[model samples]
Target: MQEKDKLNILRHSRHDWMNVVQVIKGNLQLDRKDRVYDILNEVTRRAEHEAKLSDLNTPDLAYKLITFNWQWQKFHLDIEMIGKPIDCARHEMCWLKFFDQFFEKLTEQSDSMTDPNLLVSFHLQETPYIEFDFQGGIQDMKNMQEWLAEWKVSSSCYVENIVANEQELVFVLNKK
Candidate 1:
């Protein structure tokens, strides 16, 4: 199958899964524990299956690597930023794609880690510039290098490391 086709399937699968979750959540608001648990489990199973299908010979291997990392961040990390709007949704989309690529590289370098527990902060000023700061494991030091390299490839924004301390990595981003 074509790469775009596979990506579309993955995106669709996620959308459907979210829809199902929303429905189940709505039903559970009536205090239907049994139905909620059953639906949640089924949804999770299907999501995992679709995720596997999406991973099969994925064209953007970079995307696959960072997929779980982004999932992890979505589940565990806190993000905050301040910036004037410049294609807010598009900028976010750009970041999402870039981060998927960046985090995948980071994950590969942190092979020994089970949980890197990195603390991240983002700051976006005017135009399209933003900054990111990360703190935690030694693994992050290596990850930061790849992040910088990947950041250089983007046309949406310019990224630069303002600080690479023993415990934190700080980066700034601006419009290209």
Candidate 2:
């Protein structure tokens, strides 16, 4: 990462910490102890996710995720860990490629409009698949059909298939 990018990440992270502290301080001053505790709990939850993601042995993937919100994006990404964070060093390119393509498809379909948040859940269970769950601004019927015409997600050990369910689209990365 460039020094400029590192500074940017630090600036955003510091700003977020300051915001949390201010919220807690304000709540305490107002004697809303319960709310303060709730805020702390939520912060802790998010911190745990960050910690695990950082330790997942995939620097490229982790960097992309950590800096995702710092950059201007059509949608914010929320990561959910199903079981434990898997060591993806061996297949980082596979998943990263899939992620890039998925993001491109979504952004391309947006046509300059902002899309909804994307929840990417990692499941390291028996199947060990990563899911990209996106809500809106995906391809319409034509989009899906067009995407289907050229649907092929392949990597060293990752295979992907996309499907639109109701108002959302899910791209699964299966371990092969």
Candidate 3:
């Protein structure tokens, strides 16, 4: 990683830590010890998840996730990873690009919704896969279909499945 990228990651990490501290402080000020404890536990859990991701030893993937969290402010994104992290250095950039484009399109499609929440999870197995659960509204199903078709043709990744409805859009991509 370049020094500049390292600095950017550090800056974002610091900002996140500041927010966590502020939340704790606010709860303390309000005499909400239970809430504070809950927040602490959640933060601890997230830290453990981060540690697990970091163990993958793929800086590009880590950087993409960190930068995504820092840059995208429109919706709440929750990421859950199961199983061990597989070394994906060979295709990390491709996967990162795919994720960026997918998230951008998801945000655009769901912009008019009142509450937009996205759940992205990855499972590492014999055939690793990533799933995106977007709880919002898809404005144009035709457009999404076309985009997915084009993406499928252009990328080496395989679309395991896609389920769309009035409430949410879910898709799974498997490494090919």
Candidate 4:
């Protein structure tokens, strides 16, 4: 990543922190101590998650995740990531591109829903593969499958799409 990009990310992160602080201050002024405490706990949990992501040493991935959390407003994303950082330099760009397309599709589908939830969990295994579990509502399953098939052909990674139910989909991207 370029120095300018790093600086921009830092600025954005700082601005987000300031906004969180402002919210806490507003709650305090309103004498909503419970709300303030809740906000603090949430912020702390998010900060810990961010720290773990940073430990992965993949700045691009970390930045994209942070930016996604800040930019996406329609759906709440709950990410649970475990395992040590796997060197994924070769697949970073491909993963990022896939995420962009996936999020775009998700946003289009979730626009009508009230408070949609997206749960993403990643576990980096000793077998040198990261298992990504995505559970959410999809508007069009056929379209998404077609897109993923196209992505599979373009990338060297093995893409597995498992349909758990009508509203839930799980994908596992294995390193080829």
Name the lDDT value of residue 48 in candidate 4: 74
User: Top model by TM-score, which number?
Assistant: 3
Taken over the whole model, the C-alpha lDDT of each candidate is 0.53, 0.73, 0.76, 0.69
lDDT of 2 by residue, 1-176 (tens): 69997897789999889999999999999999999999999889878787777877888888788778766787777887778777767767777876777677766664335357788877766556778777766546477646644545332444456676546666676766
- Tens-place lDDT per residue, model 1, 126-163, is 44454555554445565566557776667876676567
Per-residue lDDT for 65 in model 1? 35
Question: Residue-wise lDDT of candidate 3 within 126-167, one digit each (tens)?
Answer: 667788888876788778877876666555785658888787
lDDT of 4 at 144: 70
Candidate 4, after superposition: displacement of residue 102 in Å?
2.0
Ranking of models by lDDT = 3, 2, 4, 1
Stretches off by above 4 angstroms in model 2 are 1-5, 25-32, 110-115, 139-141, 148-166
TM-score of each: 0.43, 0.78, 0.84, 0.69
**Residues 15-83, candidate 4, lDDT per residue (tens digit)?**
888999999999999999999999999888777777776666567877777577666466776665677
Candidate 1 off by > 4 Å: 1-76, 83-87, 110-128, 140-147
Could you tally the backbone clashes for each prediction? 3, 0, 0, 0
